[model samples]
Target: MSHLLRAEYGPRGRSAGASTWHVVRAADPATALCGRTMDTDAETRAEEEWGTGLRCCQQCGSLYMHEVPHMEGSHPYS
Candidate 1:
């Protein structure tokens, strides 16, 4: 089974203070991982085992978590 986690960030670069929602695959929903606290510099990170981890501004960063689901084909946003 898989679960999804939701994270909210301030913003990044030009689009600072933007809001974005990210859908990530997880092994268990009971696990409190990303919701604990906000790591300012945690824009990029490595996952442990069950799933992947990301750190970026949901609104203004070059990369975002909310864009994961809408992506289609070999490339995203063609």
Candidate 2:
């Protein structure tokens, strides 16, 4: 049960509102345990657990998420 998450990246002095939204694939709740106290919400937990490795954009110093495309062969209709 992977989940979708939003990660942000922007200039140092900029507010979160000025940041860009990146849609990321997050681990399922059953797999995201870092031995720390859990957040009240799932989104925050996913961000904290998996957001560390996201790379910043070189051109704009912004971070973005990559969405995994659905493979046609995996779909029953295909």
Which number leads on lDDT? 1
Write the residue-wise lDDT of candidate 1 on 1-78 in tens digits. 233434445545324532333333344333223343433332322222213334433332222233343335656545
C-alpha TM-score for every candidate: 0.23, 0.26
Tens digit of lDDT per residue, candidate 2, span 1-78?
244333343455234432432333355332212222222242332433334554422322223222333453886777
**Model 2, position 75: C-alpha lDDT score:** 67
Q: Which 10-residue window of candidate 1 scores lowest in summed lDDT?
A: 41-50
Off by over 4 Å in 2: 12-18, 28-77
Clash pairs detected, candidate 1: 43-55
Candidate 1 lDDT (Cα, 0 to 1): 0.35
Top model number, TM-score? 2
- Residue 56 Cα positional deviation in candidate 2, in Å, after optimal superposition: 13
